[model samples]
Target chain A: MGTENLVRKLPNDIGGDEAGKIERVEHELLPWEKRCHALADVLDFHKIINTEEKRRGVESLGAEMIGKLSYYERWIVAFANILFQKGILTPGELAVKMSEVEGRFSDVPDTRQS
Target chain B: MSEQHDHDHDHDHDHDHAPITVDEKPGYFDLMETAVRELLIERKLFGADEIRRQIEVLDSRTPALGAKVVARAWTDADFKSRLLENGRTGCEELGITFYDDTQLIVLENTPAVHNLIVCTLCSCYPRPVLGLPPDWYKLKPYRARAVYEPRAVLEEFGTSIPDDVEIRVSDSTAIIRYLVLPMRPVGTEHLNEAQLADLVTRDAMIGVIQVGYDREAA
Candidate 1:
């Protein structure tokens, strides 16, 4: 489809429900969100690159992944990738660590509810 | 999202921006972030203490800080000029630090123009001043529509601009964060700075709502 035609179909097109119906949802912060915040703070100390560079690396992960991941989740992924690239952490080690975390949390009840 | 441009001039083109959608359940992202954080801590790359400290810093911030700055600017012409000239320095003059490298650009609302802020890519907010961004600000619908139909967005927030006023939507990025300095409401001349600050709401600073005095109370 042409770019102009695509733009015309956007929700913001005149008379669309895009703007008027957008209600804000208030959800409790998920565990991942808390983890992301912590990870973001940790990543702040890295002298290798700036926040913009880290953001670019996350954006380079393609729109599908970008859209799927939450805001700070993207930051963690970018930080992991940067660490891997710098040889601070190896892919093999990270994969093993990820499996370990998954195994550790598999039996725990989901804490999303109080 | 590829169409990148600075705030130098207005762009006339209308483009289809995609909405940011995510799954309800935790998935790879959660596991990845956990694994990465644990690994980093174990490796001594950064300590748990440092992470906690950072979170503490973020937790201490709230919209009240922005309101204080706005209230000061409202009553002080010199401070207002300083804020308009350089937001970072202006904030520093009031003892409000940037807290990070991200540049803070305060957009002033006037009779001729109304300003709205959004981070289409991600929720890049001025954490030091405004605390965390509200959920709606990070949602897909708002991110997609705020730039394209700002007037309608404002209307949804109960803010109606006159036809003569122009709306400028500022899309924030990782490098620069925006804070909207709403015009002080009328009938507030008698109010002191503390009283003025009381009138400022988080939504008002985000430009989704206008700051106004309660007519019945006055």
Candidate 2:
């Protein structure tokens, strides 16, 4: 499909397209991936973000992000953007928090116990 | 980090001892996950224990739960009818609780018809029952081709259905999930329910492969 038409259609809406062989590979969920999934459940449970909103949030990340990122990666990114869009959390705050998290984990190896 | 993406069973072991050390820098998305989760926790939306418990709940579920349901359906005529009529309540009878609002639809594969499940839009799997979907299920190729070329896809999985039998592809949506109740394999009449459940595999429940009497042969 042309870029124009691909852009017009939702990135996730790739049904009936000619595709290649199936890669029958399985990956165990990483700790972060599990945390992301848990966050999704918590968000939906507390009414902070519903399931439909999260689906639309991932869809709105555009074709590039959709194609580039893995499944849980897209979800975490979408959660950040959706939280920012809802004014529940700011991008600047997330940036600062991410750096803080990065720094805290950098010096400490056993911080994973937290 | 990219090197860690190899197709292997070793990756599954790392999570238990994958410490967040200075030597091992986390990936961009990995850091984002922790950040988003911590930020939400700080906001008091939910507690860390809740996330832990939720993860525990998710981890507890596996294909064994689905297999038990399938085994019950195979042995009990009334349960099979109930399962076909309403999957959620039928599963609840087996004490398999659904964590999400999505309704489960159990499709029976008969001698005349075979069923295949796919989420063409997204990986809308019956997660509460089957745990999480496999990586390939969420990929572009399987999602794109399964709806139109199901037989070829099944062939790739080494499941060849007869041309005389009909292939029914069920596309899972956000509100609905599908689980295929595969027909019982022959020469297993002597086997009990637990033994029969052992023969039922996850791929069989997903409609990719049929339940074979000889597990090693499959």
Candidate 3:
């Protein structure tokens, strides 16, 4: 119920699969990865962008990795994961990548993680 | 059944996101986009106009950029060596900065088999060089299939590998990833850069599409 309360305020895109999994970095991952993973958790706030009307049924919860989750969320996490793997990208660069692919016309997409 | 998709197409359609207005002034959400854009700008992260310029650059790109990268590898020995040495730099030399120049790694198709790429996690793609991914590539069908059933995925895109040639499917999960520079086609020797570049479509370079004869002239 507490998780539901946390997600209920979201604009509709950041709900499903986010429960428990979307915890604060200090409490999210194991302490071993708390440093970098926590840093990544900080960037997770950008999930708000997923609220754009163009996207539907997208969920950023780790559960979205399942095909059953909304395609938009799955793609978003996947896109984020790509940026993570591509070393040297700051959070700002990641945001730029998102803006570029926000449309069908832009060349940015996950097919080329670069 | 053939009727399956028809039934799926009947899924609910919500209009809350697309409220109509006379002259269609920016809606609350468009205002939101503006706000977000402004926030990013206000923070001095990136300018709104720079984003527009990036869009313009993406729109203007052609498959030729990839083709030149591929052709240079094919012709000049020094370039080929560099491509082999570092695919990212190779892309830069050919005017393609896939990912930041430091982040990309280009993989080539060998005589024994071909290569194709999939993000598996999401559509992690190289927008800098290849441009926006095709709609199908962005679909769950492609993402799911590209991993567990790469051969099947390739088949859907009209590409198939002979059993003799190894079909290597590279998952671009990390920055140091690979691109499938498809093997040269038959009877295409001596093709000029323009013609050669024509062979390098985003899909072909990804190995979803095969290297084909210069059929455009026909």
Candidate 4:
């Protein structure tokens, strides 16, 4: 429990008592979380790509996007990317849908405006 | 003298301001998911009803399935052998079908050894039996510490083992997921399989804690 004389012994160790510190933060799942799980389930049934392949696709997004996303959020992104790659959905259609969703959200008052 | 002390305390307070909080609004990923889901639905890639059904399948899974497997292993020796040999097929004997192609491996904790699981790369879990991985399981600290300093991480979960006991940490991957079958607690000889399962907690199956015999006393 006490952090004294902490040493980073392993090169790959990202966080540990001797390396990065540990902190706990608890929060309820956001709407995107539930939706992402559903999306992953649907993608699983389609069998268009294996879990590892999907995971690699997510990893290919680079660290910045990965850092910004939640665990399941990455899955949804990977699922969508795979769909696009497979020609099931064109990039043009996805762009249109994204703008449509954004338009819907724009009507609501921005809570973070303050 | 009091004014000097007050000035010193005020200086400390200046350095103790609360950290800036990040905006918690949904990001580009959320919008992308919504977009993809809507497009998929529109194109009939999969119906809304199908997604709902799949979610229900995920929601139906719980740690009770894992507890039943553990309790059976505790009572039946042959069943335990089968479970140790082939995790997925053995669980199927008890009517537990693992989701998709993910392999399940059950680690047995003995008197001399303890097993803990963590997925350092991603939160790979035996979701068919244990349901969703807890938030802590997916966090970076637990993932990193579980591999480097398992005993310390176990202690954080309120599990303390003697220095003599060996702690083995398993890193779960996308292909293979691990579940720890905790050692059966002492003084539970009279308990039936159903009764013993009641003592098996989700945390115990995750190897963060041990199953207790307090239910018997109650």
Residue-level lDDT for B136 in candidate 4: 82
lDDT of 3 by residue, A1-114 (tens): 578755554332221122221111112222212222212222232332222211222333334244453333343344344434444234565555345323321221223212
* Model 3 misplaced regions, further than 4 Å: A1-114, B1-29, B98-102, B214-217
Q: How well is each residue in B1-218 modelled by candidate 4, as lDDT tens digits?
A: 11111111222221111112223323566768778877777777777777666667777888999999999999999999999998999899999886678888989999999998887766788888888888887777887778888887777777899999999888887779888999998888989999889889888988889888865464
| Candidate 4 TM-score, C-alpha based | 0.79
For each candidate, what TM-score against the reference? 0.78, 0.89, 0.59, 0.79
lDDT of 1 by residue, A1-93 (tens): 467754544321222224346787766556567656645745755664456667677766666677676666667778878888888889899
lDDT string, candidate 1, B63-138, tens digits: 9999999999999999998898888888889787766777889999999988889887667887778888888887
TM-score of chain B of each: 0.83, 0.88, 0.78, 0.83
* Candidate 3 TM-score to native: 0.59
Provide the lDDT at A50 for model 3. 27
Worst 10 residues of 1 chain A by lDDT: A10-19
Give model 3's docking category.
incorrect
Looking at candidate 3, what TM-score does chain B attain?
0.78
For every candidate, what is the interface RMSD in angstroms?
Answer: 7.2, 3.6, 17.0, 5.6
For residues B11-125, write the lDDT of model 3, one tens digit per residue: 2332111112112232222332333334445455444455444445555565667778887776677888788787777777866654332255677788787787766544456
What's the CA error at residue A102 for candidate 2, in Å? 1.1
Stretches of candidate 1 off by over 4 Å are A1-20, A101-114, B1-31
Chain A TM-score, each candidate: 0.62, 0.85, 0.24, 0.66
Q: Which candidate is the best by lDDT?
A: 2
Candidate 2 TM-score to native:
0.89
The number of residue pairs in model 2 that clash at the backbone is 0
